[model samples]
Target: MGMLNTLLQAVSSAPIGGAIGAGIAAIGAGIGIGMIGKSACESIARQPEAASDIRGSMILTAAFIEGVCLFAVIAGLLAVLK
Candidate 1:
């Protein structure tokens, strides 16, 4: 019981969890963007004439993912502050 209580206290007192959350969010964002880029490239390869359209859509999707990541990072930081 004492050991368990000590473990709980350590976990609650640490701020590193929030930082880890932020890092995970950033990694997810990178993966999301990479997938978009890969799909765009494949699409452009299959349809050369629609390269511009595919590229534009990919950029838009990546931007949205980035925005979401930014929000997640901010939330994580807020958690750390609290």
Candidate 2:
């Protein structure tokens, strides 16, 4: 019980933990966008004639990912500010 209490207190008092969490979320978003780009490129390369369609779809998907990331960042900021 003592060890559990100590661990809980440490977590509650930790600085930069929120920032660390935000950074991790951002990293995940970056990876997701990178994968989308890679897949789009591969699709375009395999079907040169459909490059336009692939690009359009890719942009839409990337935008949605970016929106989610932005929302997360705003939420993180609000949490920290509060």
Candidate 3:
């Protein structure tokens, strides 16, 4: 897509720090999400009756993590632009 191409071009021209920051943000988010999933699974396994509530909480927490990750990535990209 045109947007992808533009992003690629901008990245290619940018300094390394922003790219690294973005990568770290993505990696951290992945780890956080993974931990969340693992914990949720364990909790569900240990308490089947509370599965619905745990699942809901897990999803909400994951969404919040993702939102934060998105902001971090954007900040990194904005640094790249600068």
**lDDT tens per residue, model 3, 1-76:** 9999999987776757887989999999999999999999999999999999999999999999999999989988
Residue-pair clashes per prediction, in order, are 0, 0, 0
Clashes in model 1: which pairs? none
Write one digit per residue (lDDT tens) for candidate 1, span 3-76: 99999988786567888899999999999999999999999999999999998999999999999999989988
Using lDDT as the yardstick, the better of models 1 and 2 is 1
Q: Which consecutive 10 residues in model 2 have the weakest lDDT in total?
A: 12-21
* lDDT head-to-head 1 vs 3, winner: 3
RMSD of each: 2.6, 3.1, 9.2
* Candidate 3, residue 79: lDDT: 82
- lDDT of every predicted structure (CA atoms): 0.91, 0.84, 0.93
Q: Give me the displacement of residue 82 in model 3, in angstroms.
A: 2.7
Ranking by TM-score: 1, 3, 2
Q: Compute each candidate's TM-score over C-alphas.
A: 0.81, 0.78, 0.80
Quote the positional error of residue 23 for candidate 2 in Å.
1.1
